[model samples]
Target: MKKLALNYVDTFKGLSKEVWWLALITLINRAGTMVIPFLSIYLNKNLGFTKEQVGTVMVCFGLGSLVGSWLGGILTDKIGYYKVMVGSLVLTGILFFGLQFLETYTQFCLGIFIVMTVGDIFRPAVFTALNAYSKEENKTRSLTLIRLAINLGFSVGPAVGGTIIVAFSYTGLFWVDAITCIVAGILLLKVLHPKKAKVLDTHENKKGKSVLTDIPYLMFFGCMVMFSFIFVQLMSTLPLFYEEYYHLPENVIGFILMTNGALIFIFEMPLVKYFENKKIQHLNSVIIGVLLTALGFAVLLYTASMYASILIGMVLLTFGEMVGFPFSNAFAVKRAKRGNFGAYMGLYSMAFSIAHIGGHKFGLESIKAYGFLQTWQFMAIIGAITVVFLFFLKRIIQKEK
Candidate 1:
């Protein structure tokens, strides 16, 4: 056990201090991200929103994410990632506080859209920042390290969020989320001053360098959208399924969701290290990861025992996340070296935005129209198709190699 512990610690060695600082800031920010996972329940139970209304609002959320990601990439390239990251964190914090006040359906839609646009602007800029902070050889581990922080925070957020909702109300989540965002922004600003931080100059001066024309990158982007389309149900419809279908309470659901983060925190770095040492192809890892994700979804098809099915499904999904996300990040970072890093990561982040915009709506409507069983089956099918998509992208990447 001691030997295993030492080996796990070794995975974190050699990363720059700034990378750790970035991970710290991300941890603080993500720790307060209690709203999104519970948003569907809040809208339905708290505000008495219909399923279709919730779907529309989620679409608005996705649209905002798409806009924010695009803007973040542009601004990061033009002005440097430092300005974008700090501004996004602080502004998003303020937005979350005000979000709870918007009561009507239309108001909620606009509020969520604006808030997500501001909040998600942090994504691409942070990816670019991490790239600038870490050494090349340790990049994947660095990515995994940040993901660990995120998952750790996510693990706490849902559990605490569930308790907060039960103790106070949904409004309490907004207050905590708002405060955390501002604190993270301030903490980052104080520690990583622009004058002292390693802010790389964007290559805007170089003409004709654009991600729009890159076919391979675009293909990768499509694959990510599909992957996210399947994965994002955790936030959108899955919680509702827990509440309505399995009849679990909020705290239980929160605990179940928290398991994803806890598992990733305990295991992702070592697993990423093993894969890196093996020199496994990034896309090949992604293929295996996607397959696990599909299997996770399929586990829900087991109707014998509800608790067993949900717990097993969560474990499979968490392992799939542990495997897939870091390598996808590394692949994007490597590909970005061929062009503008901000643009590449921005588009990469936007793939999630595109998925967020459509995925939630699709899942919700599927549930409304079909049923949870059919929806899960369809998502599993999408996951399989995404694996096929990743295989094609692997071919393109090899040709480039």
Candidate 2:
């Protein structure tokens, strides 16, 4: 048992110093991610908004994220990712401070939009930096490290968020969240220099420069949109379901949400590495990953409100997350073809926006009209459909290759 534990520890031993800083940066940034997870709750419980209104407001966030992704992609190509990432963190933190005062619905919506707009631009830039900073052999592992850092910090966020909300109310959530973002920005500025970063543009060409003409990349982009449409429900609807249907308390909800991080922290890198070393196909990983996500939501149906049920669902979802997302990112980087890695990442990041529009809007309406059970069922069905579509899509991409 001791020897086995030592080997597990060694799995994380060989990452680049840049990768370590990136992970630390991600951990710091994500540790304060209390606002978004509880945004629906804040609107509902604190401000007395209806679910429909919350959904509408949330879509503003999605629209902002869409524009940000495009901007990040373009700006990364021009000024490099360092400036974009640092600016996003600092500016978004300032916006979060502004959020403390907005009480009216329209003001809150506009605030949400602005915050996410500046905040989300960081996504593609971070991935671009990650790709630049990592070795090609460690590409997928570096991506996994991003998720790993996120989940590790997230596990702390919800638990701390729960405590903050209890002691200070939702206002505390925003304040703490802002502090973390600003601190992360300072850390980034201090630790990572432009000269030290690795920008991978292995096979640049006239054709590689323009993602607009890349059909395979476009098809994959579509797949990512569809995937996010279903997967993002975990963020958009799952929390509401816990509050409205399950009647879970903030701390309990935090604990449940924390399970996602805990599982990934314990299992993902090791298991994902194990599967990759065994020569498993990337497509197979995605298929199982999507299916497991479907299963996660499905668990909610039979075991609604049960503590064990939520845990079960989280395990499935985390397993799916572990197997799938890194491969999906690997696929995007694979398609980069050289100089346009940031552009590819930006395009991929837009899927989060697509997911927000599709999942939040569609889900709120479904819950209002059909009920939570049916809504989750609908999301699961969408996941299943995406699997079939991905199967076909993978075949086409492979044939083209």
Candidate 3:
């Protein structure tokens, strides 16, 4: 036990201060991630938006995310990760406060879109910085640490947001989210060093290979889009399901949301270490994780009477999240050639962005057409399809190589 404890400490110790700070930045920023989970609820309940209208709004957010993801890559490589991070943090924080004032559908939709566009650009930069700061051997674990920090913050955010919603209402949610984002920006400014920042994104360093040209990566990217479509439903439809179908209160919903982060917070790092020591293939880990995610949603099929089923589903879902992303990030990092890492990471981030449109927009439409239970069932079907697609993606890489 002592030996294992020592080894774990040593593993964490292997990361540089920049990596550590980046994890802190992630924790701080994500801790305030109260807005998106509740955005659908607010739009529907408070703003009197129809589900179809809400879907349209999400489509706007997705369009912004698409622009952000694609632009984030080109910019990160062109300028530097640190500058991108700083700008993303401060500007997006200001936007959050702006959201509270918007009432019209047009204003809210445009606001949501702009917020997503500016805010998400930091994502690729964060990944790029992680790669820049860590030892090559410790890279995947570094990814895990940052994700762990994100979950830790998420555990705090929604749970607290739930309470704030009760005590002060949705206004409280907006203020709290905005303040933390700005604070995170300031902290990031103070901590990161001048020179150690910014990996040169010049074409020479990138070897002039575009991710668009890499067909194998494009296959993996396609599979990622499908995977994200299923996975993103947690943020999209699940909360609404809790309120409408389950008739749970906002705080109760918050607690359930907290469960995702709490599970990952407790189990993800140790699990990452376990899998790393086992020397598992990254692709296998993703496949297993995706199946577990599907199984969790399938467990939702038992929501016939038991509210406890949601809890059960979240466990499987959160664990699947834990197993999937760190490995998937590693797979992405491995595929990048030199300087194009930001671009690669951007494309990877775009998977989720695109899924927001496909998952949330299309999903709301599905719920309208088919109903919630059937919609969830279809998500599971999509998950299974994605798994098959990934297997094909793996074979494509093998054949191409």
Write model 1 residue lDDT over 1-401, tens digit each, in one string: 99989988998998878888999999889989899889989999889999889878988988998999988888888888889999999999999999989889999999999998888889999998888877778889988888888877877787799999999898889999999999999989988886667633233335536888889888988888888889989876988999999889999997898787677777888899999999998888888888899999999989799999999998988888888878988988888877777788899999888887788779988999999999999999999999988988888888987
Q: In candidate 1, which residue pairs clash?
A: none
Question: Which candidate number would show the highest lDDT if scored against the true structure?
Answer: 1
Q: Which runs in model 3 stand beyond 4 Å of their true positions?
A: 1-13, 37-55, 100-103, 162-176, 196-204, 239-257, 302-312
Better of 1 and 3 by TM-score: 1
Per-candidate clashes come to 0, 0, 0
Q: Write one digit per residue (lDDT tens) for candidate 3, span 1-401.
A: 89877765665666677778889889989988688767889999999999888878978988998989888988888898889999999988899988999998999889998998998899998888887777676788899999888767866776788889999999988988899899899988888856545433223353757888887788888878888888888986898888888899999998898888777765777788788889998888988889899888899889675666898899988888889888999999888754377898999999988887777767777888998899889988988998898888778777866
Error of 2 at 318 (Å): 2.3
On residues 1-401, what C-alpha lDDT tens digit does candidate 2 reach at each position?
89978867877765678888999998988887678878888998888889888878878878888988988888877787899999999998889888989988999999898888898889889988887777676778888888888877866777789889999998888888999999999999988976665445333445456787787678777777777777777775888999998898988887787677677887888877787788777777878888998898888888635876788888888788788788888878767754477788899889768887776678877999999999888878888887887888788877976
Q: Which runs of model 2 end up more than 4 angstroms from their true locations?
A: 40-52, 165-175, 196-207, 236-256, 298-313
Q: Which one is best on TM-score? A: 1
